[model samples]
Structures are given as C-alpha cells and as structure tokens.
Target: MVSTIDSPEYTEDTFISRLLTKVPTPAGEGFAPGDDAAIIELEGVRFLGCADGLIEGVHFDLGTCSPADAGWKSLAVNLSDIAAMGGTPTSALVVLEARLGEADGESAAQAAYEGLGECARSFGVVISGGDVVSADRLALSVTVLGELPAVGEALLRSGARPGDLVCVTGRLGEAAMALATAIPSGTDHPWAERLHRPVPRLEEGRAIAAAGGSAAIDISDGLLLDLSRLCCASGVGARLDTAAVPRPAAAEWQGSGAQRVAPEQLEKAALGGGDDYELCFTIREPLLTRLDELWPEYGADYCVIGEIFEGSGIEGPDGRLDPAGWDHVASGRRSLE
Candidate 1:
C-alpha cells in the first residue's frame, strides 16, 4: 500500500490520507488521528496526547524569532492541542536537533532551553527526558501529555451537531499582521508579540468542556481550515457570518508594511492565516446562554460567528471558502525558489 502512493506532487493531505488508510483504528476509541489529540481511557482515567514540530525555516526565521521565542512556540503549539481537548497538560518530551557548528549555536541552544523551561514552569508542566542530536539546522519536536478533569469530558471534534453555534476566542488576524509587518526587535509591536508569543486558551477550553461544548479545535491552522475540519469530523456544515468574525484592530497594523496590505486583504489573511493558537469551538444551542454566563470566568472573550447545520462543507456570507491553510509540503515547494 505504501508503494501505491505514487504521486510526485503529493500534498500533506495526500500523505495523511494514505497513512490513515494503512493504520488500524483502535477499537472503541472515540477519538483518533483526525482530532487535535488522541484521547484514551486507561483504568477509568482519560488522557490526551499530542505532538507538534517546529522546523528552522518552515516555522520560524532565525532573523525574526529569538531562540527563546522559538522554544516557547514549539511547546505552546503542543499545549494548544491539549487545550483544544479540554485537558490539563502535565508533562512533555522535547526532541531537539541543534546545529553545532554555527557561531551562535551554543548561546542560541541555551536560550532555547531557557525559554522552554520558563514556558514549562508557567504552565506547571514538567519536562520529562528527551533525546538530542546534531543537525545542520535547528528543529524541535514536542509531545505533551495531559489529563482531563474528573468531572469534565474531553472535547472531541466529532461532537458538534446541527443547531450548534460556532464560536472563537480572542481576536483574529493579529498574528497575520505580525507576519506581514515583520517588525524589527525592540519596536514594541503588539502584532509581533502576538505572533511570537501565542497564548493557549486552556482555561477557556476547560470551561467550554465543563459547560457542554459540542466540539472544539485550536486555531493553529487558519480559522476557516480548522473550523472546516471540526465540521467534517462531526459530519455537519458551518455557516459563517463574515461580518461577525472578530478581527484585529487597525492600529495593530500600523507601519511601513501596513500600506502594502489592503483592508480587504487583511480580512483574507485573518480568515486563512495560521498560528493564531486561539480556540474555535461549537456549543449546542441549549448551552449558548450558559457559555455566555461563564465566559467572564475564562479570562477571554468569545464571539458566536456562525452556526452548524446538516450539510457537507463550510459556507460564508460571500459563499464557499476554500479550506486551505499553511501546508508544509506545498509551502516547502514554493520556498525552493
């Protein structure tokens, strides 16, 4: 079967589809590879596990991100996956491949470890042991393990049903703006800060799960792509009110580069940009009021920007949006020039 995957121009989606076709599904498991994390029950205790990778060029540019920030992002990305499942992260394993011959290699490596340590301490996550090796470029892979609260259930992407309200946490597009402006260090750029230091909506995820969220996904991919995945998982469709999507403030985009981005393009970036690390979720119609009442305690603002219905794909006020985001294989090919 592996030999049968013969497309020379294969995509990440194609690779994943072929792999899933070969892997055997775990019996009676409610969650599997398609979700943000794998939820498993052992001895009546549920656990969530997920892994994320950060490559030197694909995920960050050394000129733009400090080693510390890179380390923080590597771990934060995995933490967001756990948060999406409504789990509390407990421990992590980090696999680091450091370039040993670079002039700033040692110092950069130390800074990255410092950043990882600080982030782990902030989240109360312990760094279990991991492996390290020499490479031409720096890369970090993080695997996080988390446990669901006793009274709360894990939020699965398949739980959303018809009549559920589509929602999101915090404002979108700031990260996109950050990438667009590429502000220099020490510029006090809020969008740059948002791009480098994304906050995982852990508390909000727990609150949603406790309040009976129908489904949830962390917005690591673009809002549209992630929401589309949730809809597909639940066998439903989404109707988005494009006007209701909470966009970043215009002030956040002020700079020389801001002039290059049209106002309408900002909306496109907000809808399709990746690395927001916010939460996009669904709540059954009956629980919308309770979710609103409990929002203040979660320390984040949420907006209902759409609704779930019986159908096949996502639709917006302007009609259907292409479910596209940052694709590694496709992006890699483009970067070769």
Candidate 2:
C-alpha cells in the first residue's frame, strides 16, 4: 500500500513533526540529520552522513542548465558537505522526482542518472540505492555516507582558533557571474564552469585533514556568509583582505576576456554569490606553512584570505563585514544587479 502523509494539517511546522514520526527510530540510534553530517559508530569507526535536495526553480533552471550538469550538481553539493566535515564519501542514495509532459522525462531522468553515475565513479562512491516518483517538476535529492579514517579525526566549523589562517581552495566570484549573465550556447568559460559544473575537492579535504585543518567549510553560500558561519560557530571573528581573494585572469579578464567579469563587480560575486563549492578552512600557522611547501600537489588555488580573531563576528576587506552578503530567504534574482 502506498503511504500518504496524513494526520494533522500539513503546515511547515507540523510537516516536520509528522515526517519524523513516520520514520521508526531504532533503540540507541547513534546519529541523525540536522547537523553538518550525521555520525554513526559502526565496526569501531565513525561514519559521516549528509543529504541535500535540489528543486526545479530553486536549485536549477531547466531552460539553461543541462540535465547532466543538473545531475552532477545534485550529487556534487552533497559531496561538498561531506568535504566540509573532512570526510571521504563512500556511498550514496539518489531520489528523483519527474514531471509528466516534460519532453521525454525518462530521457532526462536517464541523463540525470548518467551524470550522477559519472561523478560517483570518478569519486569512487557507490550508488547503493535510490527511489523515483512523479512530481510537478524535476527534483533530485542525494544522501551521502562517508567514513573518517580515525575517531575524532573529522574537521568541523567549531574548531577554528584565534590566530589561525583562513584559506580557500580555488578562486571565487566566477560562479555568481555565470548565474547573472547568460552564457551563449556552444560557449565556454572557466568561470562558467565554476558555476555550472563544480569539482568537489575530496582529495584536498584529505590533504587538509592530513595537514591538520582545525576547522573547515565548503564555499557553497559565498565566502563572506560562510566564513561568518565559521566564526559564529567557533565563537571567533575574522579579518579578510579584499585584494588577496583570487580572481580569474584579473588583468586580462577586466574587459571582454574569457571570464568576462569586471574587476569592480568581482568583490560582490566573491562575497555574496553562492555555489562555489571550494573548501574554506582554518589551519594553524605552522600547518599553513607546510601547505605552502606542498601546495603544488593539490593543484587548486589556495590563498590565505583572512585570519581568525578572538571574538564573535566577522569582518571583510577594510575591516567590516559586508551587510549585503547573500541571504537565502531574503536575497534572490530580484536583489542582484
């Protein structure tokens, strides 16, 4: 029998309560969602778990985005969450919601699966299980399970200490620009790639873990907002230099270059735009020096953009947090220029 979400009004508040009630909780369940990654102990090892969802208009636009990229992005973002915890993704469960009359839904679905499968194969992750259902629009949700090499070895947002260096993998602002402007068909820019197809730095996460990254977060919600989260979680503050943030071909891309991003508009994209998916982390000064020595192997652009301070708040270039950072509930296409 197909189950229905019945009982009580389906308001957002009650919906959450009813959803939890339906799932049977076994006795001594060690981990659950609502955290960065759920933790469960099995075979004397700590496992990290995470789930992410992408809706039709919210996470993507079918008109401009490729189904393959849509699929890749759905899984990639979840992997990013695992990366934030300093864990390596090992398995996943995919769920798809497809709409009728959407020009070959099965083909789109298959393409989506292909994208997910490609990314999974590249990352050495297994697609253990999944589900499919009909809906008004395309929806994809992925749950990723990962393992930490050792107990208490996972990095978290709460571990940043005062005087630690704030560093980021890869440049910023390109993704935001891609969303703002339309990339012509058959056109390609590394900046647009940053927006459409993000590469989750799993290897870099392992490297950071090995190099002792005390605190870490993936750059999904723009640098300024995400770093603020790190500071708030760690009971600390940070000072970031605007000029130090990496940009795409700063000299050549100033006017009609490959990236097509103006330098003046670069700051907002780096600070307020979302979906960069690179790792932002804090490490001791000593570890930062070590990273500098072995940086070439990682291959991603790593830069020390800020430093953690002993307090509660965040600051950007010129020493004050930008009030215009991206707000999920408040900011959208209407707010951007």
Candidate 3:
C-alpha cells in the first residue's frame, strides 16, 4: 500500500514502499526488508547483521565535527541497529572511502580509523577485516554482526499488540536542535557530544527483551518515523501524549537563533527530530511495570509516551503527527539533517 505519511510530495517513505514492492527481498527464515537487521543462522545459532554508512557531505561536516567523530558515529549507527534487535554486538567490518594519495586525506583517514577502533574497544566488539577504496570524499560503510544473548529471543518491529504501552529511552531532539542552530553546539557546548557520540541503548534493549516488550526500534530517524515503522509492521496504530515525550527543559530553550519559537512548537522537535540513538518499544501493562522497575538498573531514563491501538495510523495531542525525520539522503544540509 502507498503510505502518504502526511506528505503529498515523494519522500523516504515513498522510496521504501516502492523498494519493497519492486525488490521484494522477503526474509526466508527471520524478518527482513523492513527491519533494522537481518537474522541469519550460523551453526544453529542466530545472529543479527546490518550495515550503515556515513559520507562527508551527507552525514556530517568537518566544520562541525572531526574525522574521528565521523568514524565513531558510522559504527555507532550500526550498533544501534543491532541493539534494536535485542542482540549483543560482536564484530564489525568497515569500508572506508577516502581520497588516496593526498597527505591530508591519508592523515584524516588514519584518525577516523583510530576513532572507530576506540568505539569498537569500548563496546567489546572486534574490528574484523574490511576494505579501503579511493573516493572523492571521506565516507564509511560498516557491517555489524550481533549474536542473541543466551536468554532472550530477538525482538521484531512487527510484534506490537493493541494494548501495548509505547515507551522511549533517553531524551530526544538534541541533534535536531543543534543542526537547526536553535541551540549552541560546538566544543564545550551542551549538545556537542550528544550529537556526535551518541550512546546506543544496548543494555536497555536487553532489558526490553527481558521484560517481554511487544515491539521495538532504534530512534535514529525521528520518533514519529521510526515508531510508525513499528506500527506499520505490527498492523497497529498509536496515540502519543506529547507532554509525556522526554525532551529538553524550558530553560534549555536558550536558543541563540534570532527566530524564537513557542514551547509548544518546539515539542515537535522531540517527536519529529532525528539522530537520538535511543530505543523506543511497546509493551503490555505487566511488562511496563517490569521495565519501570528495571529502568534504574539500566542506567538510562525512560518515559511512557503513548499507547498502541487498533487502527492503521498515528494520532498525537495536536492531531496526526507528521512522519518526518532527518533526511539521510542529504544529511549534511541543515534543513534535511
């Protein structure tokens, strides 16, 4: 079915619908095509695999961040995908695209690789072999493999029920606010590290798995976009309480930008903005209570922001939420990113 997604013009959703129709890469065993990762078996063990990429002019700008940060984020994005599947990240293969034979390019590429290595070490993932090819600009494509923890089954987006409680981990919209220049974001800025080095909710995902969540996704795209993916997969709908969405405080509205916005409009940033690598999931009342008790141990704040319902669309406090998010197609542009 063609999903208008509240937009008449062609959008990422349109491209995905066409891709699913034309390509039709259905999963032979586990879920595929629409999921963050593919589940495949190796020696009777299931593993989650996914890939993500970042380009110089598309995902980031050197003026705003360093080459090292690019490498870290490139891998972090893939890890978040694995975490969404309720899997433990194991290893990664990186393809670095850079301009060869240039002194500056060589140096930047080394720094980027070093940064990737740092993230790998932090996450206890091994850096498997990969390729480096010459390109016009700096870019990285990473493939990550994650094994299911011995206890819990891998989560899927297509599992939500009508009575599931919609929940999210951590605050949202810092990246959008930073990119909009709605707030300051440089070295020593409040949003600097958050936008660059996002913390993937691996542990929280495991907690969700343990608590028996009905569905889940990583909020890499905006909450509306990603949550809609879960709903579409599960054939359910949602009603979001925007006031319950965890976001910046009123004092955090210290926008340096000249065009001031009302606090109500800013709530859209938390719902519609992207780049917050937190986990959003749906669970039953019992699981919700379990997760509430488990939250403190997971060491991340969470909020119950909505509920799954018997329908095919999303409704918010204001009305239908725009299923908009960071346009990864041109992520470097302020408006798109």
What is the TM-score of each predicted model, taking all chains together?
Answer: 0.90, 0.84, 0.89
lDDT of 3 by residue, 221-307 (tens): 889889988998999999999889987554554543345545754576687777878888988987677766655474468888999
Q: Which ten residues in a row have the lowest lDDT in candidate 1?
A: 328-337
TM-score for candidate 3, please give it. Answer: 0.89
Please list the C-alpha lDDT of all candidates, in the order they appear: 0.80, 0.74, 0.79
Stretches > 4 Å off in candidate 2: 1-35, 42-44, 100-103, 149-152, 184-186, 250-261, 293-298, 332-336
For residue 163, model 1's alpha carbon misses the true position, in angstroms, by 0.6
lDDT score, candidate 2: 0.74
Best candidate (score: TM-score): 1
The number of clashing residue pairs in each candidate reads: 0, 0, 0
Q: Comparing 1 and 3 by TM-score, which wins?
A: 1
Winner on TM-score (1 vs 2): 1
Which residue runs does candidate 1 get wrong by more than 4 Å? 1-11, 41-44, 101-103, 184-186, 255-261, 296-298, 330-337
Q: What is the lDDT of candidate 1?
A: 0.80
Taking every candidate in turn, the Cα RMSD to the unseen true structure, in Å, is: 3.2, 6.4, 3.2
Question: Clashing residue pairs in candidate 3, if any?
Answer: none
User: How big is the positional error of residue 268 in model 1, measured in Å on the Cα after superposition?
Assistant: 1.0
